[model samples]
Target: MITIEQYVGKWSENEDWTEVRQAYAAQLLIQVNKLLEAAKKAGIELKNNPNTDSLISGTQYGGFRPQSCPIGAAGSSHKQGQAVDIFDPQNKLDGWINDAILTQYGLYREHPDATIRWCHLSTRAPKSGRRTFLP
Candidate 1:
């Protein structure tokens, strides 16, 4: 699991964004931690896997993408620090579409389409309690 300090923007290029990201860390930490826990419970190891590592680790993803980062959907939960895109390096958990554990942890997958493969979950509260998948 990653610490709040790991949730930073491009500090080297934009100090302002770094400050913003840090200030928002407290609000985001719990969510990120819960997400990580869910991943672990689902048997997804997010360590040094080539496809599942962080950008700082020389991979496209892992967790905590800042608003300044030029990837993912614009105005995404990722930018708000409430979401993470998990790369299932070992194809574990048979995909997160039907995982009851995720719901038990109060995490929701952003995409409902199983073909997307990777687990994209968020801590953002939904508009209605009837649904857990985002549009």
Candidate 2:
């Protein structure tokens, strides 16, 4: 499981998103942790946050991005603290996960094509209402 600090990125590049992310950390943890547990149950190892003390060591996007981050849209769910992009170096999680697994966790994911080496998940519903949606 990812700590709130790692999830929120303690030393953010902008520093402005730290406090804002902290405000959403607790609630985000409740949602993201469930999915992490689900992944573990599915035999997936989400040990992406190896550097517990680092600023942006959470994932490829490095969790809780500020507006300045170049990864997602300005209005993306990540900015709202409603989404997380887990580090799946070998694409195992993305390839293995199915609709049933997503429904079991009450979470949704971006299409595997867009995800590549990372898996983008969110508790927020997509406009298409799909378990695996296109961004």
Candidate 3:
């Protein structure tokens, strides 16, 4: 099981987030840990947490951006404690692990082709299994 301390350790590395945001991020991490453990039990290897330095330096902003917006723009989910960008330099795997697999565990998001790709996972429970950029 992932502890709160481990979650905080991972969250605190991101310099872009303020103390208040970091607290929210830590809570999100806890949810992520539960999802990750579920994925692991099913024989999946989720990517490692992206380096915070890389995430902070790679983009000027962070959050949910509309599909029409340019790449690297901020998106709203980041501010609401429901999403995170998993940076994988090689692009070896789809930003999201198999949606089918994730769906079984109640996680969902959309992936678009852009300069920088990051896996966006949400902790929010939707009424139906659908992708909503604003949610």
Q: Which candidate is the best by lDDT?
A: 2
Give candidate 2's TM-score.
Answer: 0.76
* Reference-based TM-score, model 1: 0.58
| Highest-TM-score candidate | 2
* Candidate 3 Cα lDDT to native: 0.48
State the lDDT of candidate 3 residue by residue for 91-114, as single tens digits.
333433565656665565545354
Deviation from native of the Cα of residue 94 in model 2, angstroms: 1.3
What residue runs in model 1 are displaced by over 4 Å at the alpha carbon? Answer: 9-29, 38-47, 51-58, 66-70, 93-99, 112-117, 126-135
Residue 55 alpha-carbon offset, candidate 2, angstroms: 13
> lDDT (CA) for every model shown?
0.53, 0.70, 0.48
Worst 10 residues of 3 by lDDT: 55-64
lDDT of 1 at 50: 54
Sorted by TM-score, highest first, which candidate order results? 2, 1, 3
TM-score for each model: 0.58, 0.76, 0.47
User: Which pairs of residues have clashing backbones in candidate 1?
Assistant: none
Candidate 3 clashing pairs? 63-74, 63-75, 64-75, 64-76, 65-75
**Cα RMSDs, all models:** 4.3, 3.5, 6.8
| Steric clashes per prediction | 0, 0, 5
